[model samples]
Target chain A: MENKVLMKGNEAIAEAAIRAGCRHYFGYPITPQTELAAYMAKRMPKINGTFLQAESEIAAINMVYGVAGTGKRVMTSSSSPGISLKQEGISYIAGSDLPCLIVNVQRGGPGLGGIQPSQSDYFQATKGGGHGDYHLIVLAPSSVQEMADLTALGFDLADKYRMPAMLLADGTIGQMMEPVVLAEEKEISKVNKPWAVTGTEMKREHNIINSLYLAPDELEQKNFERYEKYKVVEENEARYESFMMEDAEYCVVAFGIAARVSKNAVVAARKQGIKVGLIRPITLWPFPKKAIADAASKVKGFLSVELSTGQMIEDIKLAENCKVPVELCCRVGGMIMSPDEVLGSIKKLMGGAK
Target chain B: MTTEILIAGFGGQGILFAGKFLANKGLLEGRNLSWLPSYGPEMRGGTANCSVVLSDDPIGSPIVTNPDVLIVMNLPSLDKYENAVKTGGTIFVDSTLIKRKVNRTDVNVCYIPATALAQQNDMPTLANMIMIGKVIGECQVVKMDGMEDAVNKIVSARHAALKEINLKALKIGNDYKE
Candidate 1:
């Protein structure tokens, strides 16, 4: 389709959203992710789409909520601190069952940590950042191409489930540039907004978009219904990639940029006859528990590589049912772990020292 | 084959742009590639750098600790990254800006007066492209024919005339004797 183009990951996500029929983008500027909003600001006008830089991240997510309720494709993006501001809005979006996209190009963290690449927000993203008994459909992109592919996928998933979807990316993936073959533009006409609050004139009754339920039983029923949908999502939406698992003694479990580095470590280890493989989770919310479990049954041990103090390790342990020994090799506070370091960890798992 | 490259220089020296050009060239060759920059404060007139990976197979990591090739424009970059180049790897230093000799005898070192060449050729602020040209020519990381097309796509339409100058700079580095 002559669609291959060299672009930064953040810019690709913005372009992909446009192609995915997302005509509205409301975001406050933040490092590592500012390019995405900037691209939308420049291109949205020409395409007759809406791109508004809100006063704050909170306002931006609410803007997404408003546009999404009208059954239009809308999205907002932020970095770590800014994402925290949008959490309340995101929770409300989930509670109201509005379909939208939220992109979190994470940097170092607790509070304005640093402007370097980090995956510390793994828990915040997959465990529902805002709160309540809800889960976000989280998709993590390892490369610039995946950054684009997953943005379109996030929109599709959000629409299909009537829930908010997130593209969980780190600073490295957000700022990096690579070749990408973009997706075909989706026809906005096909997106049905029948339940939207687009004003019911004389044809039907009023459509109210509200999350507040005063009655206890009504709220309980709504929660049950949402959980039912979540179960369906978990069953059908688990996405992952398994690399060189056949006849391997141990496995490395990682996601996003960490997974990218872990793959190099695995490749290097294989060259030395270490028998190490990699299991990458593309969908962080569904968490790809089965992939890890299958590998756990065959492999002797597992190593969790991350850019944090090791949050995803808990998930790996639970997924593996704590059957195999799972160790962590990580670098925290926006620091990236080198391939050699990860390779050393894999070698240790193989019961040897390099 | 896989080529992991690290390009570093001062903030205004076009280090990121050099990485981008090579990355685009790699893409044009239908190879898997990734370009990751060291963003934030390090880019605030300090030592800015980026990692570029080009491979026949899918790239595992966009970041590299020991690069197969290292391109440095300033003295600080050379000092910081000289030891990071792998044994038998190539290190391209900007002789115009750096006067000190390479400390390592194990790796291949190419000292090109890129800044001086750019200043002398009436094309200032093109040392990065010159180093890129030299690297591509020396390392054979990507084809030299892909340079012009990559420049055309990267440079804005308003600066279309710069394409010719960029190609000329690239040729200077590619055809360098030393």
Candidate 2:
């Protein structure tokens, strides 16, 4: 029987990761997502897993990098500002094709912005956050349940693609309490980590894991291989949700908390006869462009609603290629837009009682 | 049907815990539900609130822009959210903390001296629990059996010593016919 147990989103991530066969964790405390680190610190000792609160996010992410190089399912989570510090490490992980999970329970940003929930990291998440030309498989989770579900899926996808995977959640989803069914403890035998580094003690073909390929041709070949894997990821992993779009002329496109808010606005607008729907992108990197482009063909316009002022709307407009009138409704600096606010934007777009 | 509620109060008021109980009840009843709370600096000395969405269909947004119900344990919450409740929604005010009326006739308003009632039960910490009882009593959004199961699970996991008090708080709420 699926029983309800109230748990914070941060706690959910820790519990979920552990259940997903992650016995290694490294993180630094940051507002909105600190509870996750704290929970792991307390629980990892009991589970015989290693949990380390690094001096900084960069250090933590590098810690993830070192562990991941050996192929142990590992994770490191932080808020927006701290996530920025980990960009270098993330780029290294991407370049090395290391499989790891990075949870960014996003807060308002640009610089130590407030610690409120904000979906401002749309571009950072989708555009291969760090420098370099590689991309991380980014998944945006809307609920605490997804906080668990996606963390598990992230590990699977990371292993499947041999790349870094991210859970792009907002601070609200991190801090909230919700009933999440703890996934069954995974069997020890199920941990598939043939790619791990357990002390080169294989005594068979010395395992040399190094990112430094001084030979130009060899580095080029490795880059091409990683690119091919990314190509596969993009082609197969585009995920999104469409609501009431079959008969609707106007729709809102959003993700994460913004998607949740827009969904209500669309539902409420529909009640007023405005024929509205919502398109929520689940995977932002592979970006459900076909869905949004297809939506452009069916709908008169798309309203890009988010917690950041016009950041993700850029992607929607780019995807639609101006085929449809793509308007934007947004909130920034940790402020959340109300349903009334969203509905007002939708109504005005539909030429309703604005 | 989907029932959306926003429970707001101070951090120590157990507003989040009560919201969790309601969301848990919905889950126990096999309903789709979520509970989300304020984060970061707003969580410090500021008013903390949680949005609880209980729906028959899979919940679209855990974040309710305009809640169908608003339960305020303090005055700041009432002032901040009073104008945002749906026209036909319900507003429950803790008269022990909030003195002003919501002043909107479109919404059903209930005045429960929640803190006083908890004090009457000899445990001030049960104020939020009492409020939870009253909310479930007034709305009856979840089955009584579901609520019982939820309360037993939550109180036992949360504060084992206060489990009996929380159960009694629910009983007082269940017994409130009005």
Candidate 3:
């Protein structure tokens, strides 16, 4: 029987990783996301898994790098500032073509901004925060159920593409509680990684996994190869959900917690005689441009709702190729956008009647 | 049907727990639900609140701007959330803690006096359940059986001894007159 429980988003994500055969978890404590590490610390040992609390975020991510090198399912999570610290390591993981899971339970930020929900890391997660020509398969989950499901998906996609995948969530989603049915416990050998650096005694030669190359052309060729993999991911892995969009004249594009809130606003707007709908991007790195372009052809305009000022608006406009004006509705620095505010924006777009 | 509830009070008043109870009951009934708590440094010494949504259809926004039912256990919570209840909605106030009379006549106001009742019963921390009882009795937002199931799931084994008392407190509030 499947396990169903009422869980916080953070706890569910941790348990999902465990169920997905992720035995090694290394992380440092941070607000709004501390429960995740705490759950791992308590459960991993009981499951005969390894759970380590590193001295710093930098060390934890590097620990993930070490474990991922062994071809074991491994992951680390942190909030905004801590993620900033892990960027260098994340880039190295991407460059080395290693597979692993990274979770960013985002909080309001520029620097030490606040321990509240925010999506300010869109650019960082999608455009590559770590300084490199690479992308993380960014999955934005809107609910606790998605938190669990997407964590498993992140691992699968990471292994499939040999790249890092991120579960990009916000503080609200992390801290929120909802019912989630955890996936069945998966066997450890879901992927047979051939390039893992196990002891060389049984093999013909020792496998070496690294991101460094002595020759510039060698590094450039490696970059091109990684990009080729990324192109395949972009083509096949872009995921999104469209709601009430079949007859929509205007669409609200959002993700994670913002998407959850915008859904309410869309329902309310529809009841008030406005033909509004929602387009929720599940994969932020691939950006779901095709979905946006499709909606642009049918909708009168678009509204980009986010917990940040306007980070995702750029992606939305680019996806639509500036075919229609994409309006911005947002709340930043720990404040969340309310349904009334979003409905107000839709009403204004419909000439301020409803 | 959709019900949005906001429960607010001082940090130790189990305000978040009450919201959790409702959210769990909703989930147990196979309804769509969400419970969003306000997290920040204010959690240590300031007021705490949580928003709960129970809907027959898929819930869109978990953030409740105007709640169908507002439960405030302190004067500050009452002052902060009084205007956020929808017109003709219900507002449950802990009258023992909130001395100020509610000014709005547009909504249905039930002064539960949950704190005094819990103190009288020698269960000072059970006020939230009393308020929950009153909410369930007045609104019938969830089935009593669902609440019972939720209580069993939410109360850990370490606190198993307190379950009966909590249930009794809920009964007291449910049987509350006026």
How well does each candidate superpose onto the true structure, as a TM-score? 0.97, 0.91, 0.97
Q: Give Cα distance to truth, residue A99, candidate 3, Å.
A: 0.6
A1-354 per-residue lDDT for model 1 (tens digits): 365888899999999999999999999999989999999999999999999999999899999999989988999999999999999999999999999999999999889999888999999999988878899999999998899999999999999999999999999999988889998886864667688998888799888888899999999999999999999999999999889999888989999999998988898888998888888999999899998998988999999999989899999999999788898999988888988999988877777412
Q: Which is superior by DockQ, 2 or 3? A: 3
- Model 2 over residues B49-113: C-alpha lDDT tens digits? 88998988877667766789899998888988999899899998888889887888899988888
Q: Is candidate 1 or candidate 3 better by lDDT?
A: 1
Q: Which pairs clash inside model 1?
A: none
Error of 2 at B83 (Å): 2.0
Q: Per-residue CA lDDT of candidate 2, range A54-157, in tens?
A: 88898999999999988888999999998889999999888887889999999887888888899988888878779877889899987788889888989989
Off by over 4 Å in 3: A1-3, A350-354, B43-45
The residue pairs that clash in candidate 3, if any, are: none
How does candidate 2 score on lDDT? 0.84
Interface RMSD, all models, one decimal each?
Answer: 0.8, 2.2, 1.2
Best by DockQ: 1
**What's the TM-score of chain A alone for every prediction?**
0.97, 0.95, 0.97
